[model samples]
Target chain A: MTKVKVAINGYGTIGKRVADAVALQDDMEIIGIAKTRPNFETVMAKDKGFNVYTLADRVGAMEKEGIEVSGTVEEMIKAADVVVDCTPGKVGATNKDLYEKAGIKAIWQGGEAHTLTGCSFNAETNYDEALGKDFVRVVSCNTTGLCRVLSPLDKEFGVKKARVTLLRRAADPGDIKTGPINAIVPNPIKLPSHHGPDVKTVIPNIDIATTAVKLPTTLMHLHTINLELEKECTAEDVESVLAEQSRVRFVGQGITSTAEIMELAKDLGRSRGDMWENCIWNESITMYEGELYFFQAIHQESDVIPENIDAIRAMMELESDASRSIEITNKTMGI
Target chain B: MTKVKVAINGYGTIGKRVADAVALQDDMEIIGIAKTRPNFETVMAKDKGFNVYTLADRVGAMEKEGIEVSGTVEEMIKAADVVVDCTPGKVGATNKDLYEKAGIKAIWQGGEAHTLTGCSFNAETNYDEALGKDFVRVVSCNTTGLCRVLSPLDKEFGVKKARVTLLRRAADPGDIKTGPINAIVPNPIKLPSHHGPDVKTVIPNIDIATTAVKLPTTLMHLHTINLELEKECTAEDVESVLAEQSRVRFVGQGITSTAEIMELAKDLGRSRGDMWENCIWNESITMYEGELYFFQAIHQESDVIPENIDAIRAMMELESDASRSIEITNKTMGI
Candidate 1:
């Protein structure tokens, strides 16, 4: 099989991780990476041996500042079979026309609106929906985490309603700017925070309500979830189903807090201490009068990385089976 | 009329603020403040002209370290008519016996469980319940904020069910050690956080469920509340009722965030930038299909300060009327 040439159009947290994951895939190759400026991340991308490209306008300026570049982003897009647009939240919408002009299939991150691609991709739930699609968006990290756990549960027990309260990280580890610094904010100050509606974009059948509170931690997003399953189930039964999934890991052996989870990742020698799996506390799993209650932590920076790779396979028709794609991606990424 | 002598058992965040509020009330006077350690706050309390007292065992050690003590906590309790126990959370329960042994009426902060006092005081909702009681526990800052708003609303519109999500500050501003540093935490990681039950202790008739998330904030707690009222009401109708309450302050005039609200307090020259009222966002007050939605910020350090003073009055029989006590507390504290 000819390798799918995947161009990563951003070298930040999610972008760089996706680039590495795609590089590990037997059926995919990193064509080039696009950087907006000559920052340390831009240099790091080049040092990692990925062919680096810059904005059409920044190509001259970036090279003038002693940064090497393969070509303009537009040139890279024309050469690649698909472009994974990770250029911040709203920037993906602006780059849609450029990909269209280049006549290339593109994958946008969860930051972009689902309407931008008209289809949201979650490898475990809706990979087939993205198959052969010209444009696809991988849902946001929180939504990705939610879909991973909720999809299988809904399929097994049928969800009556799922209510989640998220203790969201204020910023990614390397990010210094974003903060409440010392305040808990009802972000948007509205009921049913956007995560609930965002989940609907993927697992459209599930009844979910999410309320998110931004916190000071950069490591992970912790979710306290209460699910009223349509079918009665034991905590052990629910645990068995969750444990069966490749992307979910149960936290035990004295690892109780998010801090400990991150420490475990660091001890495991994972890059950037990334725990791509949903880190749910083993003891927190409880079945009280037919309702399931548990706490799970999502490594926001990397949980969606594998999904992005699976998204690439689905869009390119390289992998028709989602589990097969997920298996391959997981094996290569060592998730 | 003889002034009620109040003794503060802890000279920390809530304790110091309560002492100052008590000092401001015409019907109350601070007999002394109890500090476990001769910290900077201990010195500050002494410098502020509060008679600083320590544990009977620590009095010798504190005095050896050049700290002046008027008496032991037991002696202070004996002299005062009502002892406000503000020593950290579980410590109040331990000190319950001391107050009983001294044959003095006592008020415990929300840190203590309701069972310890058998009566939770909110001043607005259940001040009468605490009248002349031997032991009365003030509800938590979040609970106090909830009761102040919910009590008035439940009376005016009749609430069917109320749901609240609290973004709780991890620590007080003066606190240096407590932190996720950069994380949001599901405080109890359980369904219906303790605040709902805490509120129930004050207003048992109101059906309420609360979920709390701990954030890296030290300034204040932000609550996103959704209440289903029994009676149909417009946004204007709800706003007028809330506005009538003296303890609920509407945030308007471009005050969009908690930081600005704190800054507003500082600009107003409030002591330590304390906002004793629930700072509800004026624009967030909305009535949608019989459901009321709004955002309110609780100054965790000071919101309960006024309630402490009112509790003293109720327990001493200095004030028979709840509104009268609340009005007096509010006028003196500049709420």
Candidate 2:
């Protein structure tokens, strides 16, 4: 298979992780990294011998100070076949059109989905729908981690109702923007939360009620899940299946400790927001003969890494070729 | 009408409130105050012109050392025509039979109800059931506030489902025990939070799920409630009815500010737990034309104060004989 060319737009936490993962992939090559912000990560990316691109304002400053930078979004788009837009939510709505116009397939981050049209990809649950689509927006870390467990079970297990309480991070990965909720105590003003409705855009017909509390934590978002299942299965039986998933680790005894989840993420050098990479505990997932219970921890920053790799796979028109996709995932993950 | 005599079985924070409330009633008279541990409160009651009795291990301490105490359960039981068991849970289970055998009609606290009970009284919805009954356990502070507001509406308006997240206080008037929740962690478990099923023993048909978090403050408990009604009503209608109830306070534009709820609670002292005293904001109580809507916040501690007063009325046989009951409530509250 031809080597895949990948470019990460927005070299924030998630974007850079995607850049690093693509470089390790045997079948993929990191063509460019575009960042609008000045940060340690951006500086670190440049020192690593990768082609780092800066915005026009930075490029102009570099021009005066004799520092080189990529000046336009178009230049970054032209650098690779697949562009991953990791900009904040509203940015993706407009950038989705630009990427498609440049004939470069793009994967929009959770924040950008409000403007995208193609599909929302949660690898385990909706990878097939996302394949061959030009613009794929990966759902939020919490949603992706949960749907990985639920959509599959809801299809096999029959759900009566579901309730989720998301314990979120106080700040986004790095400084993005200070919204209204920053200083204020962000309480759930509406039921099911906006996260549930966002989940519905893809996994329709799921009766979900989500509530969230933004805590002072920085990396992982914890979701306490409760769902009534139609068929009864022993907790042991369900645990075994979840443990086998490639990206998911069935965390132990239901409430997986924060330390354990972080150890797994660190071992993988997972930046943040990597689907299925979020640690989920099997015991926290109580499957008591048709009654399913569990708590899932999703690394909000690194979960979308694998999806970004997949975007490059689609861009190269090798989506149906699992052999090529697997090569890319393994290479990107340095496995 | 013959006024009923009430003996306070335990002279602690709650017990004192009960005793003071009873003293204010014209039809009700406090036979005396009983204490197993003759602490400062017992002495304070005695100094304040109360007839105090003790069930301490050794009454010699009060006689010789000048520290008053109750010597035995037997003496406390014999002293009152009716005994109110405010002892802690699990511990109270052991003594239920003793209170029953003594023919000392009893009124129990919420925690004690899991072990004993004739009825869980909220006065407005279930007061009649407690009348003429031998044992009446007042619902939990959270349950008392929630049921009073929802039950009345559920009866008047068609009901569907309900969800409540309680940010409870670290202490109640007499909660000597440390808190179960150290911080705002989702009730360590991942299911529909078992607290709801416990609430169900009283309102069986209602689908109630509760998530409780304990904060450091002792002022009041706050609840964000979402319910699906069989019929539709505007936020204004809910506000009017809540304001009409003595314990429910319409604090306006959603009970968003925790500080504001405290202010309302302070101003409404004595009457603080009046049926409608706890503030529920008009804005926070969002109503949709559809079946589902949201309403938030009822100061848990003070909201139930009025009900406690009312429970005293019925416990003292002052409900049917209204004149004496009104006088009691007035004097206890200093109104």
Candidate 3:
């Protein structure tokens, strides 16, 4: 099997994780990583025997760390089959032209979505739509979790409108200038938070509305949702349907909490290992009389990693079949 | 005219604020305040020439905080024609026995509602129902704001089922611990917070459901509400109607903010100046194509402060007509 050659354009936290993931996946190979300047991730990737490139400086930071580089960003994309643009906001839009020039298929991370030409996707929600697509925006971790849970629920039970309250952890501790570490910056889970509603605009059947508040925590997004179901159903019925998904679990408790789910992650070896995966601990989707309430913990780094990986492979046409994409995603998640 | 004697049992932040308000009202008199230990509020009230009573000795610093003082929680009920219970959780219930035994008309705050023998009461929403009634639990601030807004909207445009996500500012920064300041206490507003189905237990023709989260802020509670209206209506109509409210200012501009309203309040010479007593910044009640998306900031301290004052005067039989209650409320608010 030909190796999937890839170049990570942004070497930030998520990008670094992506580079490592590509290197570890059997069907993938890292071509090189492009950095505005040298960062620890680039150094680490270089140490792992991958090419590291600094387009801004012909003289790379590998010298400071006593390592060698191989190519420019142009060379990196020219050599790779897929380009992952994980650069920050508008920076990705500017770098996207570089990938397009090389004719390399691109997988734009959450930040680059608005600038991309193709669909915003969660593999579970819209994988088939992603097939044969040249560029795809991986949904943000919170939306990915929501789409994963809500898509099936929307299909099983007709959804009218959903009111979502996301208790979001800080993207990082220093995200604020001087606000309380305790202040909750209420916004949607996704960028331009209301864009999640716009994504629903593309679909004819679903109407999902979300509101999020950032609490002082990292590692997970907890959502308290009220679903306007088309018909009446019990919490058990909702739980049973979600529990069937290999990637999804039913915590079987009322009102899934972040602490409860976090502890579950600790119990599940996430604290020791498997920290990258979604540690959905308290996953009960309790339906009260007619509304549904549940809490979920999604690892911002890894729960969506498999989907990002899957999008790359599908864009490259290495996994062209719809069933193949689903199979690979489920297999990667070990569902 | 005889002074309508009133005594506050819990001389904390709210208790003191209430006492200050009572001292300002001409017909009402603060007979005395009963407390477990002499706190700063008690000392300040005394310094201001109001009578104060210490039910027990100061536990001292550590003992001074969170420690209960020994004495009769029931004595306040005997000391006044109308007693206000400002104690925490179960203690409020414990004091309820005193009010009932003394056969004095009593006013209970929302926290004491769990032990309330009856229903949630909002001065605007169910003030008429409270006439000639004793043992009223003033809905929590968040609930009070929500119920007040919903009452007008529901009466004008019948609602199917309403949902609200309360982003409440902490009473102040220090409100998190045993708080005079309640910061970032998620869902601190409580469940079915104010808007529950069949509110007829307290008032008739009301069926609404709500939930809340407390953010680190003071001065306002911002409610992001989604209501399913029985009849289709334009956002302008709803905006015009809500704008018509003397107490509700439709403060929603392009990007609605609670800070704007707080500034308005300050400009208006409110204690700190919060606009409209409570500011509802939602531009519309109806959605882009479906549902309602709007935000309202309810002044926890003031919006209900005037209402609480009115309820006190009316409960004490100082006013025969409730319209006079509105006048007294407006007069105290200086509107």
- The best candidate by TM-score is 1
TM-score of 3: 0.85
DockQ-best of 1 and 2:
1
* Candidate 2 C-alpha error for residue A3, in Å: 4.0
Error of 1 at A10 (Å): 1.9
- Give the CA lDDT, 0 to 100, for residue A285 in model 1: 80
Per DockQ, the best of the predicted structures is 1
Query: Poorest 10 consecutive residues of model 3 chain A by lDDT?
Result: A183-192
Give stretches of model 1 more than 4 Å off. Answer: A190-192, A232-237, A286-292, B65-68, B156-161, B190-192, B205-207, B228-237, B285-293
Higher-DockQ candidate of 1 and 3:
1
What value does the interface RMSD of model 3 take?
A: 6.1
Q: Write the per-residue lDDT of candidate 3 for residues A16-123, one digit (tens) a residue.
A: 767766765778888888776655666677777878776746555556666576767787889988888878766777776777788878877666554465587776
Candidate 1, residue A213: the lDDT equals 63
Better of 1 and 2 by TM-score: 1
Which candidate number would show the highest lDDT if scored against the true structure? 1
Q: How high is the lDDT of residue B115 in model 1?
A: 90
Per residue, candidate 2 scores C-alpha lDDT tens digits across A1-335 of 67767777887767777777777776777777877655566678777776777776676654454435654667878877777787767876777667777887778878765346557766666666666777778777777777777776677767667766666665654544632221112356544368777777668788776666554345466666667777777777666766755667655543334544565556667544243365765545565334566766777776667766765565455676544564558555743
**Scoring each candidate complex against the real one, what DockQ results?**
0.40, 0.15, 0.19
